[model samples]
Target: MGSAMNPPSMSEAKPALSRRRGRIQLLLIVLGVVGPMLLATGMYKLQFWVPEGRSYHGELIGNGQTRADLGVQADEQRWQILVTAPKDCAVDCQQLVYLARQIQISLGREAGRASHALAAAQPLSADYAARLDREYPQLQRYPLDAGVFARTTGDKAVPQLWIVDPHGNLVLRYEPNVKGKDLLNDLRHLLKLSNIG
Candidate 1:
């Protein structure tokens, strides 16, 4: 037909290439718009139902014993709050104890769903056990031997609260002088937020 159309000119070839590039750009835009929404949904599910990933080098006490030897293995399976206090509890120590007791009680319907126990950096005195029986009938204070102290922080450093999750993993440990409200808030927060193993 007119000398075979003299082949399409190079100048005209660029427009066809530009149109193909435009189609690629449009496809990329669509993918970019949809990607974030899908990612967010996945992350939301990941936030819950995750297995216990708690990895903490528990304070190296000399003789840290597990709940098994103490016959508390079953209790440990539940969401348990474990605290180590000194053999001779001071005023501040008593304050933490009181705060912990309130926190356990505040669990209300979830109280049984969780277990809280106290370990003495030193041996538990008869008086301490009696007091626990009187005030916190539900809580049982046990004598954590010296090796346990070595496995933990150390001797003479006491009254620190360690939170153990339902999956028997040590999750959070609080420092000294933390307030009652702060502890209660943390306990509530952890209980509400995590449904881990």
Candidate 2:
């Protein structure tokens, strides 16, 4: 017939059109699900959409050193806040220890997810050590080697603080004079973002 020779009928065209429409709909559905994820990844990697300035409050160590390099066992599944003083527990040293305690407490329900320790340059006086135990029963005490302290902070005589990640990397450092709230803010941010710790 003339119609058969001329072209395909509308009814015959319907299946092809339907196939194309189905493919387009499937493509759109896939893009709807995957496009945002790809965009977010790109934005994060390029730092394009992220807010400017440091997202955290601590002084980043930038050393890339792990706990093993510093002689720690480095086996903790939780995060650790470590304070080291040049000498025995002095006023500032005691204050730093108290700050660590407060920081852990501020974590609230996440408190059990963190640990605290003090590494003294010299052996703490038994009386002072006992007092620390009484006041901060959860704080562990260690004697820090002068070389280790010097290597860590580039100044063996000054009191310093460190934050160790769950993977044992030394990530942040703080001076003895750092505000408690700032340290707490950084810890809270890290814990919230971290999946491993």
Candidate 3:
């Protein structure tokens, strides 16, 4: 009789042990799959690790100003490559203008996806204006407010390259010294990521 009772208790204990083992195995499997993912996500969110590289090369405009606010009429369906210079486009200014035109041209099959625009705080010389029209027939001209862009570019009216999205938002600004290759790389990346512009 004692042996019979012992056998029944042992049988019951076997099932309890089996269930405990199963629970532990399930917990370990969940941890194995989800642990790394959670750690990676937490690290990313916490900014504990920085990305190896950045996609865009231009300086971001923190104020979030747009073409509409500046009174520049841009194509609502295409990205804009905007060139800003002082009243008179001297050699340096002309170089920036040329850079803008070349950047648009370098887009190749996607060339039509972007449009070029020139803005000056002061009016350009008649001769230079005519030359610009003749050389870059696709360029759109706008008179920029010195006070408006001045706040962003500092006191001096240095020629600057600005990227405007389809919604007319002024997003990126690059210095005149920026390399053509850098401009191309940024534009390519923007076109790839953006469905609108």
Candidate 4:
């Protein structure tokens, strides 16, 4: 009776302890593999501890729209600073165009990685066309479709600049009044972060 009632012997206890240890080790392995992924997903969904400060000065285009959506063909495989004028290239539009070129020039060693372009809804005035031809030798030109521009930009018909990626994806948009220095900084930041054009 005493033998029958004796506490579990060491030999019998060994297997139970081993099984418990194995279960604990398995649980730890699973946690190590999947813990961070779950935590990251939770943080993204809850917007917890996310940084409030952004480095970009322009409005981010996160709607998955591309240059094609603006009715402009993507011929350049490099990063493009495209100025879009829904109306005639007036004072605001011309200023944005100049800003775009200046920003590209400020890139210095990275200049070849980027190009400046203009998309105008109406034909340029002869004097402006002559000026563009003589002064802006490297500027690319495109015809802007007003109908598509209206659909894409809603009520915003003013001139704006777009930072387009190599894959033709629209990254950011800046108003006509955006400063050249600020735009240069933004483009530099993008070039530094991106491996592609």
Winner by TM-score: 4
TM-scores of all predicted structures: 0.61, 0.70, 0.79, 0.80
Span of 10 residues, lowest total lDDT, candidate 1: 54-63
- Candidate 3 — which pairs collide? 87-122
lDDT of 1 by residue, 92-115 (tens): 566667767777888887777676
Per-candidate count of clashing residue pairs (backbone under 3 Å) = 16, 0, 1, 0
Tell me how candidate 2 scores on lDDT: 0.81
Candidate 2 has its poorest 10 consecutive residues by lDDT at 67-76
Candidate 3 residue lDDT tens string, 1-197: 66766888889999999999999999999999999899899889997775767677898765878975554555557998888775467777788789889999999998888988888778889999899878889888888777766664565667878888888888888887888898888988889889885
TM-score, predicted candidate 4 vs. hidden true structure? 0.80
**Candidate 4 stretches greater than 4 Å from native:** 1-35
The digit string of per-residue lDDT tens for model 4 on 1-197 reads 87886476867999999999999999999999999889899889998977899989999999999998997875889999999999889999999988888888889999999999999889999999999999999999999888898899895789999999999999999998898888898899999999997
Error of 3 at 21 (Å): 4.5
* Model 2 per-residue lDDT tens digits across residues 1-197: 77667356777899999999999999999999999999999998988878668866778867689765554444677899988776667888888888998899989999999998887768888898889878889887766676765675566576777888988899898888898989998998889889877
lDDT of 3 at 4: 60
Q: Rank the candidates by TM-score, best first.
A: 4, 3, 2, 1
Say what the RMSD of model 1 is. Answer: 8.5
Q: Which ten residues in a row have the lowest lDDT in candidate 4?
A: 2-11
